[model samples]
Target chain A: MTADQTAAWAEQAIAEAAHEPGSAHPSREEQVLLRIERARRRRPKVREERITLAHGAGGKATRTLIDAVFVDAFRNPALEPLGDGAVLDVNGGRLVFTTDSYVVSPLFFPGGDIGDLAVNGTVNDLAVCGARPLYLSAGFILEEGFPVADLRRITASMAAAAAHAGVTIVTGDTKVVQRGRGDGCYVTTSGVGVLEREITLGEPMVRPGDAVIVSGPIGEHGITIMIARGELDIEADLASDTAALHDIVATLLDAVPVRMLRDATRGGVATVLNEVAQAAQVSVVIEEPAIPVRPVVTGACELLGLDPLYVACEGRFVAVVDGDHADAAVAALRGHPLGEGAAVVGVVEADPAGLVLLKTAFGGTRIVDVLVGDPLPRIC
Target chain B: MLASQIRELCEPGRQYTFMEVCGGHTHTIYKHGLEDYLPEAVTLVHGPGCPVCVIPMGRVDDAIDLARRPGVIMTSFGDMMRVPGGQGSFLDAKAAGADIRMVYSPLDALKIARMNPDRTVVFMAIGFETTAPSTAMTVLRAAAEGLSNFFVFCNHVTIIPAIKAILDSPDQRLDGFIGPGHVSTVIGCRPYEFIAREYGKPLVCAGFEPLDILQSIHMLLRQLADGRADVENQYTRVVPWDGNRTALDVISRVMEVRPFFEWRGLGFISQSALRMREAYAAYDAEVLFDVPGVRVADPKACQCGEVLKGVLKPWECKVFGTACTPETPIGTCMVSSEGACAAYYNFGRFTRSRHKETSRT
Candidate 1:
């Protein structure tokens, strides 16, 4: 479905939820999302310090509100399909399986929520692993007092998103928690996909001559999440690069023989690169200017004392491909819709062991290492 | 820039050494890769800046004792949770069901005391002057509020006397100094004048900024090249000559410098530690405990002392990555992120071996 069709489907789902039988019933996750959204607002008009069950109820009101606002804003085909699961048909036998949990604080954010996150997170997880995601299963942990209406709206989005992904969510389970025992909702999803026949992905496969490539910009997802949470009072034009990148990967695989593929997740590019270097026992060099970084993300990171390289990413991925195929790989990626701004950011070299080096913009070098303590907690 | 100056200073075919007393300062330099920018003749020695590195086994044992006591809620900075005491680290106690809390600041400990009135809250106050003010403020406020269950095990130490300890030692041979950015912000450049006059060593009060450090290095090198040693201030933006008077006043009024204290690596240093005043005696965790002795004992097969003293490089220590790492730290230096060995292990060690091998051949 196109954008308009998804928008229309989202409206119908919202309308159905609002006037459905056993309306005003929301699941724990929906209620939690609403409360976090309310709490994260600039001028919170608090009538009472304590939360009530009405917030979680997915009745006509809950359905109408979420559909009219959240679903309406993040309108997409899979999200609009509003089915129970996403289904896909793969032509290849190779597959990648991955999962991710979305427990971000203030579950609702500027550009996305747990619903969109559920689809994008699992899809990206598989995409980074060199898989063309084929299916997804979402699990929800709800609180007892959550509203049915809110539940309908959230589930509606989950269904529509699964449909849009061209994948099937064949199975799911929902558990309820006692009021005050849970924050709102927690989403754990598993994704399985068939890999491209020509691709092989792993750290050990990253030989000395392979190149590391990144699609689009870095730090947008992390910065967008930070801005959504109001952690650093900063604004940016960046949105969460929270989308499935299987199509982009397929395009790259069509031209280049990938040695290894991995997503920059919790530890960002630095962590992912370090892991690759250690596993392959190869020295890695990342050019500062080659890797794409949005000015907004860079400015906000500079203001908040965060390193863009270490920030998390949901949509982007790093590819280690054969040296001779580097240009062909770049061209393949550039031809795809998701790989327009792709670039070869670094290369693998023979190192003694457990070494990752980052050559700075100023013609100097620094070690890009993992964060010692918990990094920006509550960040997805 | 100091990098340029260091390059020029070595033109006379001489070597210059600089020691940074503050651990935070040392981390800033390493984090920014400023160390490599310095010319070969210039060496920035890691000093005793990490409180976790300097904390004796006895105090850690004291903290563990408080943690293990029934109905006692012990709080500490995250770094202190992992440093092993003679008995066990706070993490070991926590894993074994002790009520141990990790707090960002002492204020969090105050809130913990307020929330859990049924349990006694013992805060392990550890750090140099950079963190002493906050701990002192908490103790003062607890006394004022008459919070009966709130207490502090004072392990606060000053930087000047510790630096003086190094300078006064018979084997002292440093050419110049890159004074701690954070500690100097608290103690100011005034107190360091005595070191310059008595020791005749150039002192550059550098900030943690890469440019500030590089600039301070330039200043120190210029002084050394002229055969003139004096105290200089490079981080004047946040710090002042007089320092934070309010914080210093509170510290002076409510605490006394320990007559003689046993630092972990530097051994016994005069007037290096702080103890609570009589007015706040009720909130002193040390007084509350009846531990027999505060003895000095080194960890088995550890080179933390030499590493902390600037006499040994982290790589020179036998157990750098072999027996002691951040994962299983045998010494305090291996545990704390700011500790010399840890910084070297985390960011530079893998490359260090590579650089060494390439140079040797």
Candidate 2:
């Protein structure tokens, strides 16, 4: 049918829904059609029909688009409050399952590649949910003209990352698209983990007096990837901080009463903190001096006019613990190999709830807002 | 110096308005929350320094037109992708099957041209002096290498003319100017002397760091307190008085100042923009392609023109938070993150509301 015919049919259905055999006493078919019409009207109309790069920017636009389409279509209690993953109760045991797709350009970077990033990303999602990641599923979509050597390197990296994280890739699938359809390859991974302890970790557990601790320095992974593209023409020893964080989480759990655990992924630490603040209805005040950022990362961010706080980190996670146990938490995190740079960066506050603020070294506080679109490189 | 010390320096009874004429400075001020420590009398007015934000809709439409060609590869700094044209944006065009790519530098566009021999690579060269020199160098390199496929859609603007336009405006009441550090690095402290000599507004060239901005503000206030209205350099490490002579020479050789150029918010200003010199006309995308050089007006509801002149604050605009948000921006000020409106909406709206409440009381 033509576009006009389809529209006419839809209009007829809606009209029938409005006027039935008996206007006062409608039939069951009429009631069903009326419900359908209401649902159709309630559906959101996105301004743009096609997806743009901003949809993946991990910002306000991304959230709106996700809520309008995916959340609306797959409406359920489990997925209602979007976190890193869904915590499902299987046979009276808590299980956390999460999935992420890796479509980063310049597949290979100084520290990691699409393969390792895919593995670490999924593992971190499950690990941050106060769970012990167990297994992962790898699915790849490769372009027809993609090199086999690159594919092998990515798969090997994934395997190495999985092994380091103590997780197995139980099942896998691969498909090849037409030459121009895909950018080399895209990897989508699903991770499953078991909740080892009875601790209930999330926004509910987050309190006003909680202390925020970061695993390491910020902006490494993002800057490394940008530099790897060979666009900036600046050389730095900076590399992606892509690592497995299950061990660090486990160690920190034993040392302190952790309230909330979150892996700073796509939107970086800023997004994660903003999510926590909004979800818990508490303000997060971070000290700029207390935050650890490598000089190289700072230089790169300075050149491009990008902020380190809003950049992505693959390996890092933020742990919020009760103020009483703040020191213990930092010590525990620092003792771990992945958390050597761990520091008490911020504190949860009562006022200005649902906002993240940074206490600048200049004795001023700035709002550490969520990432809005990609960090566009600028010369000035 | 601490921001608190600077805050103490701000005269409480009188409102001291300081305009930062660089987008990077605007970003730093908002991102670092430097405005929070300021006394109620001090206000930091964001200026028209964001190149991505000020590229009029007509230029973007022309870019999209050039991008839509069969074997054309349109390259630009990533910030320009989301900026709306008359129809939509470069992102929208890319989604609709345009070979648009984001580059960190003009050299990257040159590289793409080198890699794709058969494709015509067009770099949407935008920004102030900081970026113009690189574009000029790229053109010179293209010529040296005999790369006929490379072209530059030169939208590179001169900051001094734009600054002069702001200073000359009737409503411009800025006490001092926080000069753009990077732009000054290319065309140094010498050009900004006009502001102090002619308008008696102190211009302090500043770095992008939080501390750098705070110090610059402090320096400006010192000048205000001592009654010295002259151009000062706070970003002495990067920008010298004479500027980068080599880069300026390259820019002068390959490009020429346009007689008149239309700014999105500031309207038409003479010598406000740059174009390829006759010697490099063969590498100019505007002459080679059939782009409709149309003059599209800003949206009627948008108060960006007033905002650019520091006449109206970003939040004071009618459509600021409601219609003109970062997600769906209707005006040039809301397009790029570096834009004044976008910066306020993204990172400073909460503080802005608090300031509003304090001012009301």
Candidate 3:
């Protein structure tokens, strides 16, 4: 039968099943069909048979894959929210833990390398959760024919990055695979931090009239990596904006009452805004000219058919604070080197909940949705 | 200023329907929300210009079949990877152990062929006249370098035939056209003269900027107000009257017009697509491989044909936002970013409600 025919048959069966009295139980065959239909609606399923690069991209496919496969099997209270990290309470002490893996190709780029990226990535993940990142663990996967000199250089950079972030590598693991089995190197880092603040920071705390501020210009890291691949012939003077944001984040927290903080890493600021809007049940309307983007980055993005709003940023973050304290937050962030280019980009609204709208320069508004597929492949 | 001028030329109690015959113009219109600046009397219709959106499913299936062959490395643009075929996409094929790579240009595909001398590198080429010159140049380079393993699965199409087909359709009520910017840079302003001479519709070749589009609309409105139907150029800074002679020469030397080719919504049009010339047969994948050139029908519920013909708005489609979306596309219209359905879904849906509110006010 055709798809339409099957759908019609299913609709008839569902209608017949619904007509039965509530107190009167249905027959065996009808019960089986009802149960199958209920299960099909309730269960989360990843429809793709095999995994693709989009599954690894921090987009819709990634969210579906994680929720259907990993979260369903490992369902727990701590893992339910599925934020950047998990906040644990141990004997009245608050702790935040997060992990990230770095599979960026070429190993090194303009401003930073994979080693520093792995350390800063996990550190920022913990820092954004209102924690003081203290300890981290590193794991390395090396190919059989990999060079020791390159490994030493990477480790040295990782050590310097950890020292700068005021964190220590307390533990590590190493494994070797066949020459072709692995990319030259892959590093995974896990971080643990203690939350000593007397205030709470989360999406639930967000409310209407909150101000949205972003630290520095966006799309530097993703664009730098894309250029470093040397695939396209276009030339631009750019570099990755990869840095540890714990100090700057602490400064903002000390200055203003921040409702939430999210590092615009994978999926960029647009994805983070969507998550915030959905979680807080509010609308986010941003002004196009207010968003800080470098001229060079904008040029590269236009040439590559990419939007700078959706490109990834490693060091930058978005913060939600009270509307009155928005100026203070930007002032506090601008005092730091990593956030010298911070500005207020948008505001939260009550109507049209769970959506992000961009007010164009031409006095028109449009929706800004989350990233759907891998436009720029594997930067972090 | 252009918006005010366009408003000054608007006729009362009459609607002017103009089609933007380029995907880039469609993207610019929605991205910058140009509709809000225009008078309600003027309407802009999307044309069948998105190359990725016009490719038939059967051709995608054929590309996938070629990728599945042993010792074959298939390469294509990144946007083409997610476009669903009859079975699956290139991304799905790659996950199933097929060596399908995404390259930014055809020269990169040729580079892969040079690096791996033992493997056959097939570049699934898809685009319109703007991109055909690069593919033709790459093919010429491969021949000059004596690279025997490189092949091109040509799917490049022309815009003139598709525009003619839209004009020939009885349901269309178009008044003017916004000629394609990039395609006009290659094929020039003369190719679009037939639209003005034969159909009495004014055509303006416009750039891909918000202001460029506004100026083009203003020009079209002026022509309509003066009762003049002529081909004009608003993007003279980029597009020449006769086009690039060197690029046109290269394209003609390497490629030839096919008898007919299948478009996703527009169907088959005679001499509408390009194929490798007999002299370059060795570099053509169609000549080297046994492709199952089977024709597949569009899905039952999809109204992309009507949408392409300008008879139905993107939002007027039955399954437009409900079942067909950028995330889960049931038709080719929702697959590409430049596609009309995707542009509407991404940026223009809210405009409908805004328009309603404005009308009520």
For every candidate, give the share of true A-B contacts it also has: 0.07, 0.34, 0.28
Name the runs in model 3 displaced over 4 angstroms: A1-45, A376-380, B354-361
Better of 1 and 3 by TM-score: 3
Query: Taking the tens digit of each residue's C-alpha lDDT, what string does model 3 give over B2-35?
Result: 7888999998888999999888888889888788
Candidate 2 residue runs with Cα over 4 Å from true position: A1-45, A145-160, B1-12, B189-200, B205-229, B232-246, B352-361
Q: Considering summed lDDT, which 10 consecutive residues are worst modelled in model 2 chain B?
A: B352-361
| Candidate-wise lDDT, in order | 0.70, 0.83, 0.85
Tens-place lDDT per residue, model 1, B192-275, is 998789889999988876788788888888887788888988899988877888889888877888897778878888888999
Error of 1 at B263 (Å): 2.2
**TM-scores, all models, native as reference:** 0.76, 0.87, 0.92
List of clashing residue pairs for candidate 3: none
- lDDT, model 1: 0.70
lDDT (Cα, tens digit) per residue for candidate 2, span A79-104: 97687889999999999999999999
Q: What is the descending lDDT order?
A: 3, 2, 1
* Model 3 chain B poorest ten-residue lDDT run: B352-361
